[model samples]
Target: MSAPIQMVLFDAGGTLLGTNTDHPRWYEQFFVEACAEQGVEVTPHQVDEALVEAAREINLTHRSSSDEQVRFFWEHMYTWCFRRLLPNRDAHQLACHYIDRFEVGEYVQLFDDALEALELVRCAGLRSGIVSNFGSYLHVFLDKTGITEFFEFVIVSANEGCEKPHPEIFDLAVARAGVPAGQILFVGDNLREDYQAAERHGMFSVLVDRYDLHADKPALRRVKRLSDIAQYLPQ
Candidate 1:
């Protein structure tokens, strides 16, 4: 008995794109290459360990931290990883290089049904956008994947000075799309961050529970495939 969906906002990482288990290896390789540029010797495994530890700490702090704080933690870790690899090089510059490479090379393939589902949404006259808690370079990743044009709006928390689970972030996306909260439908992999926040703003929400982990949550609708969204549309 809910209102029909007119707008669909998506999450970037786990929802739209999947990453391989070896994803961090790209960062390790980049660190090795950057160190080689400085005439330093380092192994990919060493850089991998440093980056992993740093990422773990960042995620730990990010659970209740601001986007800037999370960025600082990531940058610090990248700096430390670079320092470990190149004793004589500038950590900040090397971190920048490694980040650039990681952004370009570290993504997993998009789900096979993503594009078809998006097209169906468009064909049904529903607008689409992306709201992600990612770094500033997310646009580059979207463009590289050729899915950027399909989205009418892209909101990254790093650019907005806020992160998900914050009502303000969802409000910003709703405002940008020029749609009322009641008409928007947000789809994401996280139950709390995407669904609960959108619900707070009077928006409909669908949780992409690919792992079947919280199947018992009664307040929200759970979908295993992007194409399942069509069932929720107006007849």
Candidate 2:
């Protein structure tokens, strides 16, 4: 079944690593805290709205896979976000500070079952890679979190000039993976981005509902833990 499953491609943030939920804003909480730590307090609501704005604004610009360009895109986004609360000059510098501190792995947390699933992929002789709508930060975060070695390679949207829910990144992953689309499985937490996107490309897809956040979610199949992926592999 499932073309014998030769390679596995996973989404990074929710699928393997997660933003520590010590606060309700989730990742936006970190931005709020990052600024507050600098004696610049911005409301969580402001940061959340601005974060969404930043993503939309940056995506409207042109695309590039160059690492430096990617970092600049995000830095520009940070500036856009901070400016919503601070003056132009303050916002630029604050955004810089946020990026510097954020790069140090201050908020990334790995899911409990992530490592075991990756190890099983390796042990079962399947190649593995991480494909995420992230930037170079993922490379460093994974290394500092001690899970980088498990991935044969990593494909970031910033590194590929495309993001999920679009076929560009998936096509790049397929080419880089060197496997037929049917022989690979894509795992992620988002239904549309991971499951539907990969499935649309002829690859198998699984949603890892590690927290059962979507027990009643419709039309999508999911597993409660990352390690459940082991059941899908050829034994």
Candidate 3:
């Protein structure tokens, strides 16, 4: 028989929290608006294209995990996107202007179901923690959202020098979880990063499908909201 889950580790951004805006393409929407603020008109599709290329460029050449490094990474990403969208404009200046406009509350929000889910974990006598591919500021973000106390630890990519789909990061999380991988339940929104990686590491995995995006994959275990996590807990 499978071991009963003793701990629950979550992915932060999409699982427990989300972008403040309701737009499905929040990243592209923000950049499209950013372009308009600079007197350039660009479609969301255009911004999405630029953003994708920028992400690829940054990932291949300039990946970093520290607080400052993370900031620098985004700045460069924005700069790349701006350069593509506004050929005649100063990309660095535009990037900095948009970056300065970010306010924590305006950028992120705790999901409606997150609190009840965490409480469920607590009431189940299961330990909870976070394993996320986030910057060093993630702890502060969690604190600002008032959910920091729920987690025993928050392992961030910036602090650990590795990110998900990579064994090293999962190793750190499993070590900190203080249980055999099979005794942990890993929940996250990403397929490869959270679900497949955790499964490969021997942890039970559940995918969070807030948008019902993966209905075609009927064989995968998933929940539409975090509150549904209770069904997976030991009864």
Candidate 4:
């Protein structure tokens, strides 16, 4: 068997924190509030549907498109959502306003048990950090959620100039922790980016399978509850 993990690295969005039901509602409310500020009238449901359609289109085209192209697709979607919701406002300004509003505290909510699990990990003498694919505001979100103190490092793809599934980002993270790859444990929801990449780099990897999809993969250690992680570590 492999040695016990001395350090733990986490994927931010789906692994450490459960998705909030308010996530979809936040987008809808932001657009509705922005429309009200602009003196435009539009229903939240209509705007939310347009945003979802835009996201689907972007996801479908992402694999074939360059980074710039993907960004353009997102911009187009934002512009369309804004235009549909507030006909009189400039879409660019509206998009910016939406982003500014998004940076505020009410949009994201942390999972109920996340802090307890994090505390348990910390008390276990394992160093912890976050490797997330997020924009510049990730630190702000973490701070607002009151969980920022638990992490020794926070590496965002936007700041690192690279996203996951790339070995270099993982290399950077390992380097930041000042630990050998073999001594680190990476837990994330993505099979390719989190589990495969970490395993490829010689780190211990845990797959958070909240969906119960891949039960037969013996090479991967799958866990549903974040608190159950303590059981996998050696005392």
Candidate with best lDDT? 3
Q: What is the lDDT of residue 83 in candidate 1?
A: 71
Ordered list by TM-score, greatest first: 3, 2, 4, 1
- lDDT tens digits, residue span 33-150, model 3: 7778778889998988888888777553225355667678878888999999999998998887766555344477888999999999999999999998777767767987899999
Candidate 2 lDDT over residue span 1-235, tens digit each: 4577989999998788876664424667777766777667888888888888888776533343556765687678888877885653587777777677666777678887888898899999989998898766788889877998888889987767788878888899999999899999899988888989999999989898766677897666789889998888889
Candidate-wise lDDT, in order: 0.75, 0.81, 0.85, 0.74
**Model 4 agreement with the true structure over 1-235: per-residue lDDT tens digits:** 2776788898887676543443435557656766777787778788878798767665531221233443455467778888777666688776755555555644576766568768888888988999876665678789888899999999887667777877778999989999789889888878988989989999988888765667788667988667667776656
Q: Which 10-residue window in model 1 sums to the lowest lDDT?
A: 58-67
Q: What is the lDDT ranking, best to worst?
A: 3, 2, 1, 4
Off by over 4 Å in 3: 36-41, 59-64, 100-106
Worst 10 residues of 2 by lDDT: 58-67
Which residue pairs clash in candidate 4?
A: none
Identify the candidate with maximal TM-score. Answer: 3
Q: Comparing candidate 1 with candidate 2, which one achieves the higher lDDT?
A: 2
For model 4, the stretches where C-alpha displacement exceeds 4 angstroms are 22-98, 213-219
Clashing pairs in 3: 65-158
Please give the RMSD to the true structure for each candidate, in Å: 5.4, 3.1, 2.3, 5.1
Which ranges of candidate 1 are over 4 A from the true structure? 22-70, 75-100
What's the TM for model 4? 0.72
